[model samples]
Target: MSHSAEHGRVRAGYNAVAEDYQKQIGGELAHKAVDRALLGVVVEAARGGLVADLGCGPGHVAGWLAKQGASVVGIDLSPGMVEIARREHPAAEFREGDLLRLPAADGEFAAAVALYSVIHLEPGELRPAFAEMRRVLRPSGTLLVSFHLGTEVRRLDEWWGHPVAIDFHFLESERVAALLAEAGFTVEARLEREGLPEEAATRRGYLLARRDAG
Candidate 1:
C-alpha cells in the first residue's frame, strides 16, 4: 500500500479509539521513570526553546514537558487525538500533522520527541521520517525516540471495542541508529529495557540523537 493509504488507516484507527486510548495510557509517565528522565534531558537541552512532540497522543508527554517549563507543541495525525490532547492538556499546543511532512518551518524546534510513535512507519519510511525531523530541528538539536525492540509487525483490527486497522512495527536499535545517522543525526545514547508489567510483553528501545552541527 502507498504511504498515504497506510497513514490513513493508522489515523482512522487512532481516531476510533482516541478517547479510550487516552484514558488507558494518559497518565503513563507516572509509571515510567526512565521515560520521564529521558524527557527531562530533552527539556533541559531545549533551553526554553520550542520543543516538538511528534506523534503526540493525548498530549501527555507534551504536557509533562510544559510542566517542566519547556515551550511545547504536540503534533499528531489524528484530528480526534489532537482535539482530546488540546482539551486534556491546555498547557501545550496541539495540532494535526504527519511525521513525513511536519507543519512547522525549517529549523523550528530545539528538540523533538517521538515516543512509541514511529512504530507505525514501515521500515523503508524510517529514514524519511527522521530526515523530516532533522529538517525541522536546529543544528545540534536533541531528539529522543522510543519503540518496541524487535523485528516484527503486529496488526490490530479492533481496539477498545472500536473497529479499526493499524500496524505496529517493532524495530531494532542498531538499524534505527544507522538510519538516524543517514538522516543527519548523530546517535548520542542508546538504552534497551524489558517492558514493564503495564506495557506490552516486549522489549523496548530508546535512542537519543543530536542533529549534526556541520
Candidate 2:
C-alpha cells in the first residue's frame, strides 16, 4: 500500500483507541526500566535542544522528555491522538503530521525519538521516513528508535474493542541499522531486550544513531 494510505489506516486505528491506549500504555515507562534508561541517554545526547517525539501518542514520552529538561514536541498522524496529547500534556506542543513528510523546517530539531512509531510503515518505506527525520535534524543530532525485533507483519483488526485496520511490521535489528545508515546516519549503539509480559511477547530492538556533523 502507498504510504499515504497506510498512514490513513494507522490514523484511523489509533483514533479508534486513543483513550484506551493512553490509559493502558501511557504510563508504560513505569514498568520498563530499560526503556527509561535508554530514553535518559537520548535526552542527555540532545544537549538541551529541541527534540521531536515522532508518533508521540498522548504525549507520554514528550512529557518525560520535558521533565528531563529538553524542549520537546509531540507529533502523531491522528488528530484525535494529537488532541489527547495536548490535553494530557498541557505544557507541551502537539501537532498532526506524517512521518514520511514531517511538517517542519529542515534542521529544525536537535534530536528525535520514534519509539515504536515506524512499526506501521512498510519495510520499503523505512528509509524515506528516516531520511525525512534526518532532514529535520540539526548536525550531530541524536536519534533513538525502538521497535519489535523479528521478520513479520501483524495486522490488528480491532483495538480496545473498536474496529480498525493497521499493520505492525517487525524487522531485524541488523536490517534497521543498515536502513539508518542508508538514510545518512551513523549507528552509534544497539540494544535488545525481551519484552515485558504487558507488551507483545517478542524481542525488542533499540538503535541510537547520529547525524554526521561534517
Candidate 3:
C-alpha cells in the first residue's frame, strides 16, 4: 500500500481503539520501572525545558513528564488519540501531527521522546521520521526512542475486536543507532530489556541520542 493509505489505516485503527489503547497502555509506566527510570534520565538531560512527546497516545508520557516538572507537548497522528490525550492531560498541549512531517518549528523543542512510536513506521520511513525529530530539536537536544527489538513486522487485522489494519515493525538496536547517527544525532546510550508478562514476548530497545551542536 502507499504510505498515505497505510497511514490512513493506522489513524483509523487507533481511532477505533483509542479507549482500549488508553486502558491497556496509558498507565503502563507504573508497572515498568525500567522505562520510568530511563525517562527520568531523558527529562534530566532535557534541562527541564519544553519537550515533545511524539506519538503520545492518551498523553500518558506527557502527563508523567509534566508531573516531573517539565513542560511537554504530546503529538500524534490520530485525531482520536490527540483528543484522548487532551482530555487525559489538560495541562499539556496535544496536537495531531505526523512524525515524518512534524508541525513544530525548527529547533523548537529542547528534547523529544518517541517511545514505541517508531514501531508504526515502516523500515523505509525511519530516516525521514528521525530527521523530522532532529529538525525540531535544539542544538545539543536529547532524544529518547523506544521500540520493539527484532526484524519482524506484525500486522494486526483487528484490535479489541475492532476490524482494522496496522503493522508494527520491530527493529534492531544497532541499525537504529546508525539511523540516528545519519540523522545528525550522536548516540549516547542503548538498552534492551525483556518485555513484561502482559506485553508481547519480545525484547524492547531504547536509545538515547543527542543532536549535534553544529
Which is the leading candidate under lDDT?
A: 1
What digit string (tens of lDDT, one per residue) describes model 3 on residues 1-214? 8888988999999999999999988988888898899889878988977899999988999999998988999999999999999998888998999999898999989999999999999788999999999999999999999999999899999899899999999999999999999999999998999999978799999999999998
Model 1 Cα shift for residue 185 (angstroms)? 0.4
Q: Clashing pairs in model 1?
A: none
Cα deviation of 78 in candidate 1 (Å)?
0.2
Descending-lDDT candidate ranking? 1, 3, 2
What does candidate 3 score on TM?
Answer: 0.98
Best-fitting candidate, measured by TM-score?
1
lDDT of 1: 0.96
- Model 3: residue 185 alpha-carbon error in angstroms: 0.5
Model 2 over residues 36-73: C-alpha lDDT tens digits?
Answer: 89889888888888899999998999988888888898
Worst window of 10 by summed lDDT in candidate 1 = 192-201
Give stretches of model 1 more than 4 Å off: none
lDDT of 1 by residue, 1-214 (tens): 9999999999999999999999999999999999999999999999999999999999999999999999999999999999999999999998899999999999999999999899999888999999999999999999999999999899999898999989999999999999999999999999999999998899999999999997
| Candidate 2 overall lDDT versus native | 0.91
Instruction: Give Cα distance to truth, residue 99, candidate 1, Å.
Output: 0.4
